[model samples]
Target: MEINTFRESNQFTYSWHAIGAGLLASFVGFASTFTLIVQALINAGATQQQAATGLMAVSIAMGLAGILLSFKYRMPVSVAWSTPGAALLLGLGVVKGGFSTTTGALIMAAFMLTLAGLWKPLSRAINKIPSGIANAMLAGIILNLCVAPVHALAAYPLYIAPVLIVWLIMLKIKRMLAIPAAAITTLAVIYFTAKVGNIHAGDIMPHFILVKPEFTFSGFISIAVPLFIVTMASQNIPGMAVLSVNGYKPDAAPLFTSTGVSSLFAAPFGGPAIGLAAITAAICAGEEAGADPGKRYWAGIVCGVAYLFYGLAAGAATRFISISPPVLIEAVAGLALMGALGNSLMNALSDKENRDATVITFLITIGGHAFFGIGGAFWGLVAGLAMTFFLRQRQLKAA
Candidate 1:
C-alpha cells in the first residue's frame, strides 16, 4: 500500500513538472512574438476582434504542434508564431491589405512552406548552413529585441526603474528564476501604482472575428514570398540548428512539415505563420532548464501547455494587455531577452576569423537598414557572407 502511494505521488509530481515547463516555455515563446502580431494587426487595419482571433489561432496551432511534435520525438520541440513574418506583415502587408489580404498571404506562405517540407532534399540542403553563420543570423535578429527594454526605460523612467532594479537583484540572487522575477516585479509595480480602472476597464473584450482568405497573385508575390523567406531563414533555420547543436537531432522534415500543416490549419482562424522558435528554444536548451538533455523536453512541454491556455483565453488575454501600460510590457520583454542577446553576441564575435564578418552582419542588422524591399536580417547576412568570401579569397591567394 505504501509503495502504491509513493508511485502515484511520483507520477503526479512528474506530470506537474512537465506541465510547469511547458507553461514557462509557452510564455517565453509567446512573449517573444506576440508583440509583432499585435503591431501587424493594428497596422493592417484589423478590428480588435479580428486581431484577437489571429493571435489565438496562431497560439493554438503552435501549441498543438509543439505538444504533438515534442511527444512524437520524445524531445521538446517548440513551435512559435514567426516574429519575422509579423515584422513583414507590419511593413508590407499592412499597407497592401486589411485582414482579408493578410489572410490570403498567410495561406499562400503556408502552402509554400508545406511544399518545402515535401521536398526533403531542399529542406536538408537548407539545414546544412554553417553553424557560425546560423548563430550570426540569430544574433542579428535578437539584438534589437534585447535593447528595446532600455529604450522603453527612457520613455517611462518612473515605472521601469523599480522593475529594472528588481530584475538585477533577481539575476544576482536567483539566476534560473530571473525572468519570472522581473515579470513579477513589473506586474507588482503596475498593480500598486497604476489606477485599477486604467489597468482593467478601457479596452473591449476581444472576440472571434473571422476573415476569409482572398487569393491574390500580387499579394502572394510581395507579401507571402517575403514573409516565408524571412520565417524560414531567420526563424526555422536557427531553431533547427539549436536542436542539432544540442544533439537531440529531431528530423528536419517533421519539424518543417508540422509548421506548414499547422499554419494551414490556422489560416482561416487568423493565425500568422507558425515556425520553430530559435530564441525560446535556446532558453529551454540552456543549463537553466536542466543539465540533462532528455529532461529539457519538459521545458518545451511546459511552453506548449501555457500556449494552450493563452490561446483559449485570447480574448481576455488581449484585453488584459490592452489595459496594461506598454512600458511594462516593453521593460519586461527587454529584461527577459537580455541574456539571450548577450549569448548571441558572444558566439558571433568569438572566432577571430569570423569576427570581422560577424561585426558587419551585426551592424547592418542592428542598423535597421533595408534595401531593395528586403529587411535588415536578409541583407545583413548577404553582406556578411560576401565579406567573408572576399576575405577568404584574399587569404588563400596570399598563402
Candidate 2:
C-alpha cells in the first residue's frame, strides 16, 4: 500500500522528465541527420519527390517500431533508420536501376533481417562477422562524405564559414547540440544566400508515393547486401550494446523482428531499413530519462511520437536540400559523421592481430571499385576475410 502510494505520488514528475528526455533525443537525432537521409536518397537516383517519400516512410516506420518495442518489452529501445546504411548509399554511385531498383534491394535486405530474428542460425552467422571488418567497411563507406567539409572550405569559403563556426561553438557548449546547431546554421545560410527555390504547397506537406520495386543482380549485390551488412554490424548490434550499457535487457531477436517487419512495410514507399538506435538509445535509456529505470520506456514512446511529427516535416526537409548547395549539406553530413568515422576506425584498428587485414578491408572499400556487378563493399569483406584466414592458418602451422 505504501509503495503504491509513493508510486502515484511521483508519477507526474516521472512523466514530465521522461517527456523532456524523449523530445530532446528526438530533436537531436532528427535534426542532426534528416538532411543526410534526403541527400543520400537523391545521390542514389531518387527524385526529390521520391526522396521525400522515403524520408517520411523511414521516419514513420522507425517511430512506430520504437513505440511498439518500448511498450512490449517495457524497456527504452529507441529505433532509427540506419545511418551507416545511408552513408553506404551515398558512396554508391548511381545504380543502373535507379531508385526503384534500390527499393527492391531494401525489400531483400529487410527480409533477411526479419529472417535473422526468426532463425537462430542466421543471426549467429551475422554475429560471427568480425567487428574490425564490419567497422572498416563502414569507415570506408563514409570516408568521402566525411571529408566534404574540407572540400567545402576550399570551394565555398564564404558559405561554409558560419556553419563550421557555429558547430565548433556548440561543441564547446554542449556536444549533443553541436551537429543540430550546425544543421540550423546551414538552414540560416541557405535562407539568406541560396533562398530555398521552387518550394510549393506540396513541398511543405508530406505525401506517400509508392515506388515500384525493380529487382536486379546489381541491385542485390550492390545495394541489398552492403545495406544489410552495415545496418546489422554498425547500427543494430551497437544499439543493443547501448541498451545493455544502460542496464536494459530486452531480448534482441524480438526487437530485430519488429523493426525488420516495420522496414518491410515501409520499403515499397522508399524507406530504407529501420533498426535499433545507438546514439538516441543512450539518450532515451540514460538516467536523465527518469529516476527509475523501469519507467524509462516512456522516453522511447515519446521519442516515437516526436519522430512521427518529424515525418510530417519530411517534405520541407527535402525542399531545403533540393535548393541548398550540395557541398554545404554534404559538409554538414561530414561533420555529423566525424564521430562515427573515428569510432569505426578505432574499433577496426584495436584488434592488433587483425590490424593488417583490417587495413586491407578499409582500402578496398574506400577504393569503391566494382567487379561483375558487385561493389567495393562486398569485395572488401571478401578480401579481409581471406587475409584473416591466411594469417590464422599460417599461425596454426607455425605453432
Candidate 3:
C-alpha cells in the first residue's frame, strides 16, 4: 500500500518486527565496521582514548541523525559514519599534524557538506556527477580492503578458514547475517589463537575524551575535500537511491543540512564524517521493516536508538579490536563490503556511453596513487570526467 494511504488507514503499530529489523541493521553495520573505524582513527594519530571517543561520537551522531530525520520526515532515513572516509584515512596512513589536524579536517568537511546542502548549485553539481564514475571511484577506493581476506588466508589459513567457511555458508543462507556471524567467529578465533594478555577485559567501558582540533592548509586540501566528495557521492547518494527504490523522495537539501550540522557537533569528540547509510538502509526501508511504508520510519528510528546503546559500549568494542589480529578484522570488513563492490562494478560498466570512462576511473582509483597529498579517488574522477567530456565532444562532431 502507498505511504499516504497507509497513514490514512491508521494501522501503525509499534511492532516488534520493525524494531527487530532496525536492531539487525544496527548490529550488522556497527559490528562489521566499528573495528575499521577505530583502526582508521588510530592510523590518523588518535590516541586509543581518542579513537574510542571518535567511534562513540560518530555512532551517536549518525544514530541521532537517523532518528531525527526518520521521525521528522516519516521515512526510513538512515545515517552512518562515512565508511569510505574511514578507508580514506586508512589509505593516507598517518597525517603530519596528527589526530588534532584530522579532527579539524572533519570540521571542514562538515562545513563543506553544509554548503552542499544550502547552495543549490553545489547540490546540482554533485548530482551532475555521472553514476558510473561515482560508482567506479567508490569501487576503486575499497578494492584493497575487499581483497584483504585473500592476503589474510595466505598468512593465517587456520584462523581465517573457519571464519571464511562460516561467512560463505551464511551468505548462501542469509546475506545480512553473513558479516555479523563472521565477526562473532573472528572473536572466537582471536580467543583461541592470540595471547591471553591481548584481551584487556577491564578497558571495555568507554570514557569521554576531548581532543582540540588544529587546522592546517595541507589537512584541508588532503582530507576535507576528498572526504566530502566520498561521503556525498558514495554514501549519501546511494542512501537516497535505497529510499527511492523503496518509494520515498525526501527533500535532500534539508537532510544534508541536518547531517552536516550533526557532524559538526560530533567533531569535537572525534567524529570523522557522517552521511546517509546505503547498505544498512535497505533493512529499514524495505518490507522487512514493515508491510506499510509509513510505519517503516520507526525501524530507522529504532536503529538510531540502537546505535546510541552500541555507542555506549565503544570502549569495550575498541579494546576488543585492539586485542584481535588486525588482518582478521580487515578480512571480516572486506567480506561485508563484497556485495557493495560487486554492485558498484556492475553499475560502472552497465552503460555503453560511459563504459570506457568508468573503466578509467576504476583503474586509476584502484592504483592507489596520490599527488600533492590528495588521494587517487579525486584523481580518478578527474580522469574519467576528462574521458567522458572528450567522448561527448567527439560524438557531437560525428553527429
Indicate the residue-level lDDT of 232 in model 3: 95
Task: Rank candidates, lDDT, best first.
Answer: 2, 3, 1
Pairs in steric clash, model 3:
204-316
Per-residue lDDT of 223-330 in model 1, one digit per residue for the tens? 676567667876787798887766666667778888999999877766788889886787665554665455566677678778877786666445555555764665
Q: 2 or 3: which has the higher TM-score?
A: 2
Model 1: weakest 10-residue lDDT segment is: 1-10
Top candidate (TM-score): 2
Candidate 2: which stretches are off by over 4 Å? 1-14
Candidate 3 regions exceeding 4 Å error are 1-13, 196-202
TM-score of each: 0.74, 0.96, 0.92
Which structure is stronger by lDDT: 1 or 3?
A: 3
Give the Cα lDDT of each candidate: 0.68, 0.87, 0.84
Residues 215-333 of candidate 3 have per-residue lDDT tens digits of 88778877887788889987878888888888888878888888888889888888888989998899999889977677788888999999999999998777767777778788877
Q: Which predicted model would earn the best lDDT?
A: 2
What clash pairs does model 2 have? none
C-alpha lDDT of residue 224 in model 1? 71
Clashes of 3: 1
Question: Which model is ahead, 1 or 2, in terms of lDDT?
Answer: 2
